[model samples]
Target: MGQKINPLGFRLGTTQSHHSFWFAKPKDFPAELQEDERIRDSIKNYVQKNLMKVSSDFEGIIRIEIHKYKELNTTQVKIDFGRQNLLTREEEEEKDDKEEKKKLELLKTKAKIIIQLIPEPYEEPHILAEYIALQLKNRIPLGKAMQKVIELMEETDIKGIRIQIAGCIGGKERAHVQWIREGRLPLQTIRAKIKYCSYKVQTPHGVLGIKIWMFVDFVDEEFVDFVDEEFVDEEFVDEE
Candidate 1:
């Protein structure tokens, strides 16, 4: 049972750190936690809506870090939002287009969003996860979808990769789990650097869950992810 814990949680103090950075009083914790979920969902929708437009160069979000301020009563979401420049150029282009803007804007009414954009070269895990989710959304078969992902990863020089899918696969009346793995994954090694992502894809059948784990190189290169924190794209969205 202990071994069944999430890999990130297992190595939190060792190789990984918290994605959300916030402190809340016991009385205020639940509301803040739900706010965090809403923020993540909004970001996910933004990525899905805009991915095809910029798929040529834009990469998937590697991770999201949320910092909440009690004094300011605001939350700042930092993601690899893959803004090679701005958080979303699509958002910029849609300015004259208010209908789409109204549809795509973050759902929060009170919290101002300060999007900090930084270029992240690490696209191993979330990219694949998004690929699988997209495939499922298009009604692709599970086996074929999983196969295509393996083929795509073969071109990369990563150490290893593992993918897991669950929840009503292939439009079945029952739900089950399936997975595919290739190369070598040193999951038990404490020093092994791995990129992980869990994603949910909605379909006509039901919602499917996907988890991807990609083993990056060892920690010798000094953990090459979100290296520069100076670059920021602060967008002040008008409260609706």
Candidate 2:
């Protein structure tokens, strides 16, 4: 904020006083005359007479009202001016860079995945367990949900198995895996559709959608147990 002050102002009644006058006087004047009141009076009268003549000769004389005005020294005003110029430039660049970085980070953390499962009749529990293991394998590494599914089918002598694999979409950090085996007809079907269909997940900060499709052989109880015992524990601990 800038202060508003009156310009051309007088202080201590100094305006119109003789103390404000400047004149060129001869240096050769007698030393004694310099201190003489009569000499001083003569010099004042001479300067005043010429000043009056010059004022009268002018076509128009404008009188301005005087008020006290705050004066900023050259050095102080220069420092302030430089700071204003620098801040204007810096603010614009900083704003642009911040927006660009935010966009790049958003691109990096986007979430996506695909899963496929083949459920066997008379083996619902084993199939569900195998699907869970497969989901965990996809989430982790070096484990095969599809391989376990295949093994289970081979052991049970089931043929022509086809399980619908669903897509789950959410923030990588907050995504949850859920299993459902039974429910009201419509609700169960809806859940299966959602799990299979491409889904758009919303978070407080942003949104991401994913498409998924997968195929596997059979469920392996041992592999599922391993995932439950080892991989899940590691994931939770690592997150903590």
Candidate 3:
């Protein structure tokens, strides 16, 4: 009657929803299904290339969403980037960000594509998974990576946090699972507002998989919404 399942999928109507919104004809469904993969890969590669050009640390992509409208002949791609900063002075960092925006505008015109870049909030599941992926890529021990990220998340207002990493952890020959947790993660409670994401990273030794489940308390949810609105408002208010 019961089996292992994704928390988001299990509670779809209550708390989780699809990031992409589009429909395809049955004949075109197979090709359209693979389109998301292509979009994600292209954006990932483009972001990495841009980072290398700027010599900046990977800021991590939290999610990429696609929406197509056949009647309008339009496709919309939105990307949410994690909260990672460049190693520089405040003024230079702001300048770099402005320059990146300018470049994106140029890209939109040249590529005939509409892409919206969004900044992900602190300690989201995909953002955490990306942080751990970078640490793993750098050959950091799994425990240290989990502990470091968890310690940071502890300062936030999350109700609970859990992380799992599997496959050749610590560069061992055999694959194993390692996990770390802080506070309560009520999988049985559909109202708990849990966000989950699974990510895979390729290391020199082997491939490692990471899963993060974040329980966010709804008490602060209003403040969270306000922050997003404020951020969006700033762009228009401050833009010349």
RMSD of 2: 41.8
Put down candidate 2 lDDT per residue, 1-240, tens digits, no spaces. Answer: 676221112111211111111122467334323323332243234323542354331111111111111121000000001011222345434523442343234323211111112223223323233343335434532124444544554565333233333334222456434322222212112112111223333333244332222222322322222111221223323332
- Where in model 2 is the C-alpha error above 4 Å? 1-122, 129-138, 141-143, 168-240
TM-score of each: 0.67, 0.18, 0.72
- The lDDT for every candidate, in the order shown, is 0.66, 0.27, 0.66
Error at 6, model 3, angstroms: 1.4
Q: Write the per-residue lDDT of candidate 3 for residues 1-240, one digit (tens) a residue.
A: 777888877776566556666788999888777766766666677666666457444556676655555555445555565644532355345544544454345333211223333344556787678778888888787778889888878878787999998998877889999898999999887766888889888889889899999988543222222122322333323332
- Arrange candidates by TM-score, descending: 3, 1, 2
| Backbone clashes, candidate 1 | 0
Judged by whole-model lDDT over C-alpha atoms, candidate 2 comes out at 0.27
- What TM-score, to 2 decimals, does candidate 2 have? 0.18
For every candidate in turn, the CA RMSD to the true structure comes to 6.0, 41.8, 6.3
lDDT of 2 at 197: 22
Best by TM-score: 3
